[model samples]
Target: MKQLMQALIDQGARLIGLVGLPPMGCLPAVITLTSPFSPRQCNESLSQIAIDFNQKLQSELKAMQTDQGPTIVYFDIYQPLIDILQNPSQFGFDETNIGCCGSGLIEATFACNVGSKICPDPSKYVFFDSIHPTEATYNYIFKKMQPVIDEIIQGQ
Candidate 1:
């Protein structure tokens, strides 16, 4: 990823925005697979991997930000996602353990199609399906990322 970003810089790109991975362990699909209980929770081990990967990416990006390198901005999407999971009520989401579409367990993409059962209120759920977030979740993340994005745009 760093190499590709650097190559883009070499190709005359002045600004590069890198969005870090979200908390994969906290995803409904991952919880269903890893959790032993009925109401699944986040798999800490899996979450750790995402955190570690993001940290490594941040470190590498910092190292690569020499005088010749392009202005690279690392947008930390992990923390805000984690915050939403931990405090769903604060984010106006009532469901954090499961998704809004289908059974809210393993359904994703095609499985969450027309015939699938959906929740009455999608806004109450953080995820649209097992692997994907709802529009509200994305909007919340975008709002949280705005300050960093603005700073980057201002060259701060």
Candidate 2:
């Protein structure tokens, strides 16, 4: 991923945003990836994969934080999402771990939707299904995190 980003920069790409995964292996998709029999405890021996990579790039970006160049910007979507999930009630969400979709521990393909039975109130839910969020949930997340983005832009 780093190599690919660097290549894009070398090729004169202007903007870049690393909106990486949100602890995805913890999500329901993995259950089907292995099986329902798979235990969550198995993901214990985790590597510092995204953190290491992003921090390295972040340091580079810090150095390149000058008011020059064609907007060497980075949008870190991971940290804020994790923070939101940790405090879902702040965003009017009573639940975070359980998806609105009834397809427990299955892939996002079997997600909650119109045809697939979904929660009557998507606004109260964090995830619309195993992977995505409802529009209202996204709106709440956006409103909550707008300050972070505004600060970054203003400080820059």
Candidate 3:
């Protein structure tokens, strides 16, 4: 990470944003794979791993952000996403466990297609496929990140 940052700095890059990992256990794919019977529940083990990684990453990023080259910003999408998943109705999301495409249990990428079954409203789902977030979910994340982005831009 330090090397990459230096490389970017060498090329005249100033501001850098690093996104934290989402709760992988809450994703449709992980739930389907690890807790098929209890689809609504997320795999806590995987979620913990992501959480730990995010914490470490945040710490590292903070250490990297000196008066040296670039201003490294760590964008935490984990908490906001988890908040939405825990309270779907708050974010206008009806489905937090399953995705909008196909069975929403395991389908992803090319597996989601015209032939595959889809939810009536994609906006009501947190995930578009098994692993990706829907547009609405991304909108929420973007809004949450807006303040930080504004601060970075204003500072520059």
Per-model TM-score, in order, reads 0.91, 0.63, 0.94
Which regions of candidate 1 fall more than 4 Å away from where they truly are?
A: none
lDDT of 2 at 71: 55
Better of 1 and 3 by lDDT: 3
Q: How well is each residue in 13-78 modelled by candidate 1, as lDDT tens digits?
A: 888888888999999988988984775889988899999999999998898887866787789889
- Cα error, residue 95 of model 3, in Å, equals 0.6
> Tens digit of lDDT per residue, candidate 2, span 1-156?
556656877888665544444544334454245335634311312214555666777787766644544455555655655666767787688656546776534536634445776666767776666667657667765776577578767865
Pairs clashing in candidate 1? none
Local accuracy by lDDT, each model: 0.88, 0.58, 0.91
What lDDT tens digits, residue by residue, belong to model 3 across residues 1-156? 888888888899888889999998999999988888953689989999999999999998888787876889999899999999999998899988889998898999999988999889999999999999999999999999999999988998
- Measured on C-alpha atoms, candidate 2 has an lDDT of 0.58
Q: How many angstroms is residue 37 displaced in model 2 relative to the true structure, after the best TM-score fit?
A: 8.5
Q: What is the overall TM-score of model 1 with all chains considered together?
A: 0.91
**lDDT score for candidate 1 against the true structure:** 0.88
